[model samples]
Target: MIRKIRQYIEAQNLCLPETKIIVGLSGGADSVVLLYALQRLGYSCVAAHCDFHLRGEESFRDEQSACTFAASLQIPFLKTDFDTLGAAHQRAISIEMAARDLRYEWFEHIRQEQQADVIAVAHHRDDSIETMLLNLIRGTGIKGLGGIKPKNGRIIRPLLGVSKQEIMHFAQENALPFVTDSSNLQEDFTRNKIRLSLIPLLQSINPSIEESLVQTMAYLNEAGKIYDRHIQEAIPAVFDEESGRIHIPLLKTFPSPESILFELLKNYGFESERIGDIAHAIDSQSGKEFYSEHYRLVKDRDAFLLSVRTINHEPTTYLLSPTTREIQQPLKLRMRLEEITSDFQIKKENAVAYLDADILQFPFIVRKWKQGDKFVPFGMTHFKKLSDYFNDHKFSKPEKEDAWLLCSGNGDILWVIGHRTDNRYRITERTRRVCCLMMECG
Candidate 1:
């Protein structure tokens, strides 16, 4: 089993000779075997354990066993305790998800601090097969079907070629002592239910179910590689990093736009279920928008704009006093109070707004656009609803959400700030004091 693991590591190019590795030691049979194997293979190894505090005393026992095992081998042991339930509540996520996030984040930190070449986890063929099954049950694309990878970035899974039976046999042969989590016997979690009930039923149907699933995942991984190649080639034509947008024309050049879009956006927190809706909107309308946890996608005319959602805990409305020269919150703007002269010229740019200071009130309000908001657009005689103005300008939902309005003290719109200005406050030849507002985005 050790020879097979060594050959697999060499073939996959997972780790270089004499590389420093950090092993995720959970005190389980698989992880204990992994730590022992890496040490025997002549690599500088450290055992890192995470006690999620989910199983009460069992969790602490696991940590203790892991530390003892590392000490027996004279390897450094790193451990951390987490308030798993508290983290789940704070993140508004499931306990399993919170634990997984905490585990990986801490592992990465340990790897960096120790200057380890790669962080190795004890995930075998059974775990990969289970992952593929879970993704399939949830309705996944090619990427999800590809299952677990042997090496992903700085994380390497050297035990992927071995089965659970092989790992158990090797552990017993080597007289490796390990602790088992009591939670594994419980059927509360989805993974536990699948492992305890679903996998046994499947094995009853076909004795070689795990092997078959592994083979299928191998084929799917190859197909995913091809899919990734096409996406990389298509990205140059479709995505523009300078403008931070995706061109719709180039996206249509692909035969499977829906699949291509799923592959492109899956990493950006977009779920597989939302990709079809996004693909449909790509051809249906130009103002449709979709949102994920960290990013937003807007379908603009002939393009899709991607932007990070800003979280502002500060007050949304900012005040500009009569003597104020600039305001920076929400957006950057330079305010200049000057007397309009015969040589004074109105700037043609929309970002620069010149208003009549005498007609406006003090403490100008800078806030986001609201529903039913209306303003007399510059050069227009009648009032226009801000919604209608947004529609006329073909603003997407995300654009409308991001739009800020500069208004007078009496709640009258003065400028749309980077788009249009109100006619009520526009500078005229009869005006004496001019309030020049210039927006600086770059």
Candidate 2:
């Protein structure tokens, strides 16, 4: 078993020579075996446990046992306790899901603080099979059948290629310490029901059920990559973003509006059923909009415009110079000038503004607008709400989020830049000289 595990790690190129690893120990048999096997295979490991205090004293025992096991190997140990039941009540989810979310959040926090290069989880072959079945039984797409990845971002599951039976025997053979969670043997949770009742029934037909499902998942994951590539290449052209709106043209253009809408709505985190609703909303006239936390898809002309809506940014400042760094996307900025030019101009197809450089300061900052950021609209006499100005201009949700302003360090508004230029800095005939400013995008 040890040799087979080593072979799997080598085949996958699992880890670097001395990479720091944090093991998520749930005091279960699978995690226990995974922790010991990683150490046995010559890797640096630390143990971290999440105590959700749902099972009263039993939760404390799991943390104690997890700590002792880490101490046994002289590995660093970390633990956090949470009001798991309270969170479940607040979120209206089961204790299990709340605990799951809490655990992963803490693991990420610890992973960052320890500067651990990789987080090793104990998700064996059988668990992947169970996940596949669970996703299929509920509503799922091709990506759902893909199961869990061996490495996602900073996470690594070294035991993915290992089976639960193999992990159990290895733990027994090494006299490893582990805890038995009674919930695993129950039929209450959906996963437990599938693991306890469904998988065994399927296994009766094929004893190698785990291997078959694992292989199927590998194939499905590969196919999902191809499908995603097609989605990425065509989605932008089919769905347009203009003036902070999201719209889909593929409804009339493509034969399958359902497939196109799914991919389009996905950009805004909308699921398949929601996509069906969003597609249905197209019958309404323009100005029809659907909103999410970060984005909104509105019906506009012939296309469905997807716009981002949520913003919570503390304004920031940046310096700009001709010889300095290249100005990039989604920025409103100002450039420095020693003196006013005879023809001061800022020219873009949509953005064109001129200023008198004599009164303008050298150092300026670019950041998001504040609550009461009133600016003269170049030819206007009064100030308008920066937010209201954006809404009145029909700036799409994303445009508002990406909107920025160049300001003097002394709190004077130079120009709103792309959306609108400020009148205070607008060049006039009375001005002695003009400073030209322009914006170019690749």
Candidate 3:
């Protein structure tokens, strides 16, 4: 096992000698064998076990056994506990998915915390074949069909080229005792079902199904590298950034937009279905948008633009009711009452006024836009709907929601946030209060 592992390391060229290696130990046959094999090779390794408390006392036993194995080998052992069932409940996903999430997360946490250069998993040739078959059954892209890589970023699967049969033979020959997980015998999991039901049927035809599939994965892995190189080169051409937006012009070049969208999104770490939705708006007019966890895509001409939603806040209204008063939120309004020597008129845009001063109220409020809002413009006497104004201005749905509007307690729209105020609030010839309000709109 040590000899083959050394060969595997050399073939993959994982890293240099000063690099620290951390092994994920489950106390199962594969992981135990990996721990034993790694220790014999003397590659500066440590065993890290995650006790996903799903199997009750069995989970604790797994951790104990892993600790025992590391103790016997005089290697450092790291242990962690997690509630597998509770995580599933919180995520509202299946137990299998939750366990997978927790497992990888814990593995990465330990890898970083321990400063390990690579986190090794004990996935053998049979496991790789099963992964390929599973991906094929579920429908996957070139990367997924490439199966588990021997070295994926910080992960190194040294036993990926070795078969389960070889590991068992080596364990038996060395008098190694390893516990078997009963779940492997059960056909509930897709992988177990493939191993118990599908591989045998395939072997009936090829006799060397596992070997053939592993060779197939190797070929696909090479092909996938070439495909990935093209995708990486193609990204800058397709991705566009302007006015805080991202778009892909490649959709128009291809007759099948879906294929392009899927490949593009795969590069962006998004699901294919979401990419389909992004491409669906290609023919639609501008301002059409789709949202993801961290990014948003908006249609712009022939380009599919990606945007980061950011909030740029500004002061709402300027009130001139008081002689000398300042509004909070970095905004201040100036007001002064001066007798006019000659007759003159002030436009609504220049200053605010009202027909009467008896109706004016104090403690004026300023705020952003609200739903079901309507206000009269400075020039127009007719009330304009905020939604209609947003539509006319070609604001996206989220942008419309982000717009600000100034209103009064009496349900009067004083100012159309950051632009101008209603003519009803303009200073006129019969103005009793001569006031001015200043806003910090940026």
In terms of TM-score, which candidate is strongest?
1
- The superposed Cα distance between candidate 1 and the true structure at residue 139, in angstroms, equals 3.0
- Residue 264 lDDT in candidate 2: 62
Over 1-442, each residue of candidate 2 has an lDDT whose tens digit, in order, gives 7677677777777788588888999888888888888888888888988888777788878888888998898878888889998999999998888988888888888889998888888898888888899989976777889887777887888887878888888888888999988777888789999998888898899988777888899999989998778777666656555543334555556555666677666666876667777778767676667766677776655556665565556435666544542355345333434344555444554564567766776555667777788787877889888888887887754456567787765677777776667788766666775655556543
Error of 1 at 28 (Å): 2.7
Q: List candidate 3 stretches off by more than 4 Å.
A: 56-68, 78-82, 90-93, 101-116, 226-244, 248-251, 254-260, 263-271, 285-388, 408-412, 419-442
Candidates in order have lDDT scores of 0.89, 0.75, 0.71
Q: For model 2, how big is the CA root-mean-square deviation?
A: 9.4
Q: Which number leads on lDDT?
A: 1
lDDT at residue 93 of model 3 (Cα atoms) = 95
TM agreement with the true structure for every prediction: 0.81, 0.65, 0.72
- Backbone clashes for every candidate come to 0, 18, 11
Worst 10 residues of 1 by lDDT: 235-244
- Model 1 lDDT per residue over 65-177, tens place: 99999999999999999999999999999999999999999999999999998999999988888888888898898878877899989999999999989999999999999
How does residue 442 of candidate 2 score in lDDT?
39
Backbone clashes in model 3: 11
Q: Relative to the unseen true structure, what is the C-alpha lDDT of residue 213 in candidate 2, on a scale of 0 to 100?
A: 88
What digit string (tens of lDDT, one per residue) describes model 3 on residues 1-442? 6788888888889766666889988888888888887777767787988877777777877778888878988889988887889999999999889988898888888888988888888998898888989988986778888788888788889898788999999888887767777789889888999999999999999998787788888899898887777666565556543444334455466455565567866555566667777767777777677766666666755566565555446545444345435554433333334444366445444234322333446545555566677877767779888778766766665555545544554767776555667767765666664434444434
